[model samples]
Target: MSPLVHSGPRAPLRWAACTCSRDPAFVVDPAVQLVFKHQGGYATLERVEDGGTSAHEKNEPRFRPYDGRVHGVLYRVTREDFEKLAKREGGYVVQELQVQTYDDSQYNALVFVSNPLFKLPQEVIPTEKYLARVREGARDNYLDPAYQAFLSGINTVPGAGLGSEYYNTPSKYMGYSFLVIAALITLAFFFQH
Candidate 1:
């Protein structure tokens, strides 16, 4: 199964390995590598066929379909980094999810599940700034062409994505600096907002 999940009429979503690394983590299987996974589990827009509703609908997370989908990327991080992600706010619980690739290969990966106990009182809409970055990452990684088209087709927030460089540094030290910015950015976004 592809680590990427296409829930409905939404941009294809994938689990990118997030790191503070200055360079890309070679993910030989999925045919792509992640640069970052900024918004771990904020909400984005998604379309549902069959009028999706859970058996205990009230007990599950409510759906808020928007004009576009929320971009959730999985940054492949070290076990240490994974632990850090597990400690993020918004009550995101990290769990192992078996992702299926096109060749029917399965890879065990960590996915963040929103806590049922700490529900956001308001709708979780992604800022334009956040979604764009995600799209750029997907494009840069050479993901599926149709998926890229879907990302391009989504209605975007003009001047909505985070404008500044998430991190600026030289490329020489990339081998050692992968985790620095990821941890910092995740903290900044999680706490500052």
Candidate 2:
């Protein structure tokens, strides 16, 4: 069976947006020798606000070559589901890595990592809402207790959920453009009356 490793928000069945089977094949360890670095912030696609576009930076799970290991849940997926997953995870690069389950069993699974070219210069703290999803996934999957604690301890930018005050604010020029368009429409309406 083909397998996929989910170490982040997608670890929880609830947060998993993929159409794969709801149940995990098994929880596994050594998903990779790579260190789990949750700090890397990447720019999501541009969000439009007030007729202007702004790209929001958000923290996402990524792995790097380090001395530690990443533990995660392994899921059995069909070829169609795997293709859908690959499409959904367009921002990430996929690699096949070996993972071991609790019974010391091993399977080759596909793991996703943020593309290095898209990584931000400095780390951005994840939002509380985002962290909650990650926490829920780890808890739901019964990941390593120490790893769960470490995940819990990571600080978040309070109230930084999407479209919150922390996200893209319309530029002054966009604001002005909106006002000008409104005024123009109002003038046109009056002239037609």
Candidate 3:
């Protein structure tokens, strides 16, 4: 009889955001890190600035200009993990909040754990191949070769090197060229006299 092998299903995690009011006004800056833990491991949290409008809708009772919300980054984790993290310290109950006027605002929150409805592909092509394809596509689309060359030159320039300093420091070469020109001019003047 052949031995049986089983692989457990992957967990589903939805990126979410939460907003709460602080009695003492707090300065929320962009790029703050948030962390969440699960049975398997902990996932890093990402904070995105809530734009001009508040997270809640204007008509909603919870809506407040002073209130702030932290946006989460996209990731995949299990529902059980999410619940466990939510119940632990620093976990806030996911709730739906609305914001008016901002059409691109994300409102829905994860109220309960559920099965992952989507799965992302696992295999990724090598970086070199991917970039080569981008370059090929640009060539196919009739991108300007001169512009591409200019970008390549800019990217190729090293910040610091013997050759780079020799080329970049025009003052050194300019002074030498000026001296040669002055000597040639002086010789011509003497011959003319």
Name the better of 1 and 2 by lDDT.
Answer: 2
lDDT tens readout by residue for model 1, 101-158: 4344445656554444332333323346655665666666555555566555544334
Clash-forming residue pairs, model 3? 13-77, 34-45, 57-98
Worst lDDT run of 10 residues, candidate 3, spans: 1-10
**In model 2, how large is the Cα lDDT of residue 150?**
65
lDDT of each: 0.40, 0.50, 0.30
Residue range with the least summed lDDT across 10 consecutive positions in model 1:
29-38
RMSD after CA superposition, every candidate: 15.8, 11.3, 24.6
lDDT of 3 by residue, 1-193 (tens): 0001001132122222212211111113433322111111111223335654221222122211222322222222466755654664232234332222122433333432111111111111113332343344334433345423422221111223323212223344566899999999999999999
lDDT for each residue of candidate 2 in 88-131, tens digit (9 for 90 to 100): 66446776666676567678777776554443333455676666
- Runs off by more than 4 Å, candidate 1: 1-41, 44-76, 102-104, 117-125, 157-193
Error of 3 at 173 (Å): 76
For candidate 2, the TM-score is 0.52
